[model samples]
Target: MVKRDGLKWWFTVAMVAACWRKGVAAEAQASAIWVMGDSLIDSGNNNFLNSWAKADYYPYGIDYYRGPSGRFTNARTFSDILGDWLEVAAPPPFSSPTTAGRRILGGVNYASAAGGILDETGQHYGARYSLNQQVVNFETTLGQLRAMMSPANVTQLLTNSIIIVGFGSNDYINNYLMPNLYASSRNYNPEAFANLLLNHYARQLQALYSLGLRKFFLAGVGPLGCIPNQLATGQAATGNCVETVNQIIGSFNDGLRRLVGQFNDGSHPGAMFVYGNTYGVFRDILNTPARYGFTVKDRACCGIGRNRGQITCLPLATPCFNRDQFVFWDAFHPTQAANVVLAQRAYSGSTTDVYPINVQQLAQMRL
Candidate 1:
């Protein structure tokens, strides 16, 4: 195989090994996988919310298991695919009435569409569950668990569990850079805004730590400028990435990595913060789509306007028949095909893909 092909094959092997370990780990642990984040991990909460940012219609979930279960993507997201790889079941969305009973045992998804680390971010979308709100909701879940089982059992279940978090993108895209709706960009430069976001995010994670969370799978900001939405809307849309947006994302990601190190080194004892390289993973696929089995790397499979991304997939939008060929399902989300690849990388890949330790190593760690 050529050098590029060899690298791709190496990644494939790592993905395969990561997945294969799930079956083995299933018998060795009593852990669950919890999810928290923005649209990337939102299963269906936005459906019930009054947000304009919703994916409860057709063509949106054209590639999903339930046709359109309100996920932001066209099919299984990183959360679902990662859960499957870890041999942990998909957690019910927190907003779902059915999330009660033993369903919470597996874990629960507290992510929301257009969610952000800051409460004021993404208000244009309406009732998005901010990270604080999600944690507040988690407190309620903890209450429910305490009622359902012994304190020791609840503690055991939570301490060993891995809670994956994917946020930050919307704070930039939906808030600071959101045209004229927000004056945040005028108020804060990229560095200042990044510091603001990082400080707030650190508090949120610390809150989770206070609530008994020990293992955290934190996803960094991806190459936001290359997303079809940014390409179609930003000035750097003409066959190139929006360098400004990418720079902003890099600032946030850098701070996030430093924060992760602090959390692991001292801020929280016995804590495991595995940084998930959402940026590098997406960048790789974007750089060489063919190597990753992707053909349409710059357009949404279902949307309207430039690159089918100016607007999201509308109700009854005619979606591309070849969903797998496209990297994006809508303006701001990856297609299921891409997510499947990222999930494998998140669970077990090199430091370039996942940092400190992958989800597999983090899961098996006794601390």
Candidate 2:
């Protein structure tokens, strides 16, 4: 009788343990957002990476509540805006010492300044996390979550999580077209280089898939030649957008969208890729700055030059009287107001704004 009673007691304890573990797993999956990419989406990860591509200083975050929170942009990035639209708090940087424990339950941002699709794309910055490295860093977070819940549940959480990735611009501007060191453009045609970038980028996305991420929000390179820095330096010959460079950017965005279609059309089962139409969205804003409540589309709000470009916003750099009237905050990044406009379109705009369905649709998808 004693032996039988002991078996019953052990059985009850086992059942209770299983129930508790399942509950933990369920909580992790209810739809979290995990960010991975370059400075465009970085929310302070570069601060921990000790890279010069950082933005955690004066004038960088003057628009943010905490000020210069290390985001490349002047204020909240599009990641933050999208999260707010979904009613999910923006994830804290995974590298932050202050970000840990249940607070991490919101999510984690692993983007770094100067990061690119290709590992060698941003070496000049010194100490940027490549796209592949960001995925590896995500593996570390998966381990932490697995310890709290079952591995299967952890996978479930990732499969349902929203992932936003923005990269590749630096690969062209910083590597292929840099004045002194690299000569990739001379070696390969624009179309060929764009193809090379997409090839590697496709593989990176596949790696994320292997780790159970199913919902992907992939943004193609923006109109690079139109950014203030490009016009001030390389394309100054025309004092207008380098149309050839923009053509290359278009090729990449087209290729990226094709890849997304491949994933959705049964190439990768259970994967959903929403290509954020940054190329079109940004071009629209630039073409009609007043339509978006801006007067200055070419000049950066916080730099010194014909366009407040030539240099990124530096420490104590003078800023514009109205950040809202400017589309760009620095030489490269969009101002917070501009980001909000982009996020709104990406959240629920027409098919032209966000192909394959908007982020709002992706978030509500079952499975």
Candidate 3:
């Protein structure tokens, strides 16, 4: 009887030890992910700045974290939603000196509104920092991380970090398409414009790869034709999506996917890149706005006037009755509820309409 009891106790201890070891290994697998991109990922990084593309104050984060106004920081953009997932499921911190119990679960977001991959595009937006400058910012962020941990820890950060890049919208809207509508540069061809943009984007990605970034989640440009701003300003009819602008978006995404395939086939092991198809996601929402609890899919929720299309959602404008029922918050930006749906699609890998390579596939890639 005594021998049997001792054996049982030993087996329990062994199982517990094994479980702990497995837990530690899992934790080590997901050390830290880094996110860098443009306004789509910029929570409030530009809110402090004097810019038209800003979301620093009230009503923005109202629906987030149970109606809390100040829930999201400048770094907590849409891409950072993945960080929330990591925080909940990632294992406990490693016992190494590098981690220092700093909880390597969640990532840091350095996305800024109006940020672009090219310096010229940045100049067009009158932004303080370009994509290269944002890369510098990321380097600085990594330097800070290095100061907190050892070289091994730094390696863990580099190897495990899932870099997410969400851009191209600002370039299309503020720089190319919108400018062509009003300026003498209207002679610009969409195909040539897309090529110029993609060339710069390719260089930026290569720069990041050279700096040890392996994993990437890139959000492609959405259906620019369906945005409320375009519909209102460009005189698009109700229930109609702008086909010409969407064609340009499609071309850009195709080129981007090819570039990603090249990277995957190259020497970088475990390096994976996937697109976040905001276009398809938004299209679905526009097609069946009621499914997502949205009533006004083609109009601004916070702008003034009965047309709902002519007004801009500013301090002087009247706010909507139910923001949750609206897809767009202003002339250009999406509402918080729309962002939530987009985040869910991006996370659950249902955004195949936007990204051909889902998160699960990217996560399974061998480093």
Candidate 4:
């Protein structure tokens, strides 16, 4: 009887320990947010890269508490704002030297400035990590995670964690559109180009899935024509954006929405791919700027030239005093204020902003 009782006690202890481990894994998943993409959400990966697509300069992080943290914006990116709302720390860039050991538990940001879905998309910018490379980096991070936690716990953590995959803008902005520098325009039309992107994107997402990421927020490309970059091109008349540019972007967004559906249609098993309607939310903000407290919708706050966008915010350039009122922060990115708006809408807004469910919902989901 004494031996039996001892065995029973050992069994009870083991069960309790298992439950505690599961509880800890759940907590980690609930708090982690892994960011991957282009400059739109790049925290600081470019700082460690030998790339011209860097924002490690004055007036870039002038508003951020850290100051000039390599973010290509006046302040926080969209992921930063969303992390605040979710009560999670903004994942440190994967390239940061400090992103090792325990620092990765919160998560890691693999987004790189000018990075895109295609490996050669942002080659002009020099040495940006392509989406494939980012995924490979994540694999390295995953190997580290597995060492820290049991395989089961690590898988559970990944299944419950939120992964943001935002890319493709550079494929068009720097690749297809730059006819003199790239041959994509001569090779494919808008539909064909978008289809090409989707094909490559599908494979990339599958790679993440194979690595155990079950929840994703695929942010579609926003309206490029409305931004100062396209406006400064003189393709559209005053007070009017290049409609053709917006139309091409729309094709990509539409296909992306369908791709999200396909991913969730019992194909990946417990995988939830949420489509973030960035174009819709941004357009809404532009259509009724006062509703979002934005006053300057046409020009960048720091760029140079017609509509202040001929060139991106030059080093130490004196930006607009009232930066909060402006939409575009430079030729390519949004202001912190605009990022806040986008993050809020993506966190809990209606289907118009985030389809299927929002980030909050995805975090709370059992799967």
Q: Highest TM-score: which candidate?
A: 1
lDDT of 3 by residue, 1-367 (tens): 1222343364356446545766676442345566666766664455444455555455555455533222232123355454444432222112112432354434555566666665655454444455677688767656766787787867756766777777777677766775743341365577666677788888888778877777788877878777766776654544566677788678777777776767677656657777777777888888887666678887777655433555555543446767767777766677766765676567655546435566545555557
Model 1: clashing residue pairs?
A: none
lDDT of model 4, residue 127: 88
TM-score of candidate 2 on Cα atoms, chains taken together: 0.89
lDDT of 1 by residue, 86-191 (tens): 6677888999888998999889999999899999889988998999899999999999999999989988899889999999988998898875998889999999
Can you tell me which runs of candidate 3 are displaced by over 4 Å?
1-29, 50-52, 65-77, 88-106, 122-125, 180-188, 237-239, 305-311, 316-318, 354-356, 364-366
lDDT by residue for model 4 (90-207), tens: 8999999999999998889999988888898889889888999999999999999998999998987787788988998998898888999889899998999999999999998999
Q: After superposition, how far is residue 238 of candidate 4 from its true place, in Å?
A: 5.1
* True lDDT of residue 89, candidate 1: 71
TM-score of each: 0.92, 0.89, 0.78, 0.91
Arrange candidates, best lDDT first: 4, 1, 2, 3
Q: Which residue pairs clash within candidate 4? A: none
Candidate 2 colliding pairs, count? 1
Worst 10 residues of 4 by lDDT: 1-10
Give candidate 4's TM-score: 0.91
Pick the winner on lDDT between candidates 1 and 2.
Answer: 1
Off by over 4 Å in 1: 1-30
- At residue 240, candidate 2 shows an lDDT of 60
